[model samples]
Target: MQENLPRKAACIGGGVIGAGWVARLLLAGVDVSVFDPAPDAERVVREVLANAEHATARLISAPLPPQGTLSFASSIEAAVEGADFIQESVPERLDLKRRILGAIDAAAPADALIGSSTSGLLPTDLQAEMSHPGRLFVAHPFNPVYLLPLVELVAGGRTAPESMERAVALYGAIGMKPVVIRREIEAFVGDRLLEALWREALWLVNDDVATTEEIDDIIRYSFGLRWAQMGLFETYRIAGGEPGMRHFLAQFGPALKWPWTKLMDVPDLDDAFIEKIASQSDEQAQGRGVRTLERIRDDNLVGIIRALAAEQGGKGWGAGALLREHEARLRAAAEPAPAGEPLRLMEGEVDAAWIDYNGHMTESRYLQVFGETTDALLARIGAGADYVAGGRSFYTVETHIRHLSETKQGEAFHTTTQILGTDAKRIRVMHRFHGGDGTLRATAEQMLLHVDMGAGRASRATPEVLEAIAAIAGPQRALPIPPEAGRGISDLR
Candidate 1:
């Protein structure tokens, strides 16, 4: 785990948001002690954690550290005793929240940081009754906190600047994007925008302009996609038609005063209105329970994030860029190779997208996985991104793959590489693909040629690279050659 990660953390509530906080912390390999008075608090947290693990297994391709331990404390004091980080997610009532924060402040270590998961409450008020108010701030996350990367960090009047800095690093290390609010204000940024939209949505439903499902369809099928990728200002900048933001504002500025939306009007949330909204939402859900709906939402969100991650030739955009950075850290933190075995270079599960019509792992993904293994080997031997940028890299010239067994979606897999032979400009290698249970699933034998990208011709590897390669190849020479190596189409036939 990285140094930015907390040694021990505590969650003071186990409702939806609190459980989500616990899930995110535990999955990032931070031990968590949770305190919530509800009899079902442990069960709720465990269930949410399970969902988080499932979604994360599909989303993060890099190897994760072993999961951290989780404990349920009998009281807030017990939970926060030695915790370095504490997050509170009790109910929305300001009085109740203040009392809880006060308790947490007194019970937690003097140096421990406390964060309140208050979506719209002012952090200044929440920290008012606290003894060490400097360490308190708001860390507002969206529903399913484990998946959503955006967390708004708002400092109160007394919040220490250093605490804010430390909070940024701590949350960022666990795969979150923590944006500091410029000033303390109710609702912060995201919720302010959402509140305006929600108000309009209510008016639409109240006046029977659109049903709940219809409103949802309008958003998800249109600007929601735009917001997912380019966001508001940038998307409208494109709508500006090359003149940029000024042109956009000039074009749409007049529309803002057109009395088109009842955004400022409040809808009566009387029982009748509540029933109307709930019934419409139920119809939209089609009888799915909350747990089922949560899974569905998580799966959809994963798909959206994954698609964004694949954009821009894989450099990623928006949240995808953040996901890529975290994955890079995970790769850097991967465990070192064992002393006497083939280099265990790559590991991943068969993604749902990798399944074929016959419900087995598709043929092309096998080649892709083997290709990634070869990339890992190159990265290990001093021929990584920087080396390629300097105009030299190894390109595979030939490959032979023999599929030995079946693989299904979500089945865990890994590849081990054995150096067959190596010289100045060429190397031959064998890659064995194995299932999670250690069954041999496939093997690929490949021949690669070192090339100068600028000259587009075979070239000797730099001495440093060759030395690293020799260090790996020399010890492995004592190992016997794999029987599957050097086989051809004729042999297979």
Candidate 2:
């Protein structure tokens, strides 16, 4: 994954896919300029960004780069004027795309990478009209683009290999998995597979073999769950049993010759057939609006991705591995202490799962935040991985928490820590939790004792570690006392 990302981007066309690129770039701290002649373009982009805000906040633990400014330009030249990267997401019409891509190529700097979000169109055709055709390529991303991480990168005939390289790097830096289609074909890889399944599904419905809902249930209940983790090849390899893949394939491979699917033909979309399909689809969707359904899909995806991320720390799999790696990158790239300010050690918006019955962050999540804050502090003061590996570390022996305000899901929050006192055997620290507005949301005063893991007994920290702790503690000795620092339960004396 590329760690370096451009600070400015221009997007051509602000429809569904274009708006998605805008959200992704803006959230990643890239100032964006967008051009779309559609009347409702601004509203469409805003709504998608709102949804992106909610979903992206819940999807990860690390704070994102500061949001960048967004602007709509009247003309293509105005949009791509100083953009470091340009993306074209206009409709798939060949002529329209060729015109826009060519315009972007002319206006954007010679070095800026230009990407077209065309799923099936050849990059060669898309770039044919461009003066700098070598700088243009296809960068196809999945729907609800801000949430899904997959992007297919296809290089055109005249495309510079460096353009594809830069596209891969840019997509990876933004938390996407870029699959390179080294040899370009008509539909690329993923769409071809999806088309095959979709074609079979249509035949089944047309012949009254299965309803749309039934087909959905069949996939969801069976291969879908497996696909989320193990995926097709790995899941099948496991299912191959004690003798392994070759044995299983030998036994069942002949079934491919059976008349299991009508792959050669498509059901005509006549009025009756179209009505039948639309009716089934509407019944499946119920009464939910498009935005509402998109939110639902985003929520389900967030839950799945978070669950996979959790599994990554133990026995990792596909999506989980990607989630964990991306999170690690985010964490490593997070901002550090600014000048003399208390470290912005633990900062993240509340997760959707943290909300309780009262619609605020549950009481326990506050303590969880405090614990994460302490962990960050510990890492800073030489009690981190290496110290723990040496079989001695500090354990929270006592903690007092005061909740001054309720925190809600999607609210940006951070914690600042002050070292109250530290000696050879124990340390006392005070943590203040603040909302993005600087209102104190909670306070946690914790006392930690050094323990020898091998002996299971209290012990003094080594002089080196104690010196590191005191170096930080000494700087905060003059800080004013916090109001809730020494308070007891119910504010008892």
Compose the digit string of candidate 2's lDDT tens values, residues 1-493.
Answer: 4356886899999999999999988887789999999999999999999989888877765657789899999999999988889989999899999988878887898789998998799998887898889988899999888988899999999999888888888988888889999788988988888889999999999999999999999998999988888777778788888888887788888999998977778999899999999999999999998889989988888888877865632223576567656665665677755433455676767877889999999879898789867766776677865688889988999999888898887788878888887888998989989997899998999999999999999999998888878777776777777777778877456
Which residue pairs in candidate 2 collide? Answer: none
Candidate 1 at 475: error in angstroms?
4.1
lDDT of each: 0.90, 0.84
TM-scores, in order shown? 0.93, 0.86
Winner by lDDT: 1
Of candidate 1, the 10-residue stretch with the lowest lDDT total is 332-341
Query: Which pairs of residues clash in candidate 1, taking residues 3 or more apart in a chain or in different chains?
Result: none
- Give the number of colliding residue pairs in candidate 2: 0
lDDT of 1 by residue, 28-63 (tens): 999999999999999999999988988887787677
Deviating ranges (above 4 Å) for candidate 2: 1-3, 242-244, 314-317, 371-400, 419-429, 445-474, 477-493
Question: Which ranges in model 1 have alpha carbons more than 4 Å from their true place?
Answer: 378-393, 424-427, 460-475, 491-493
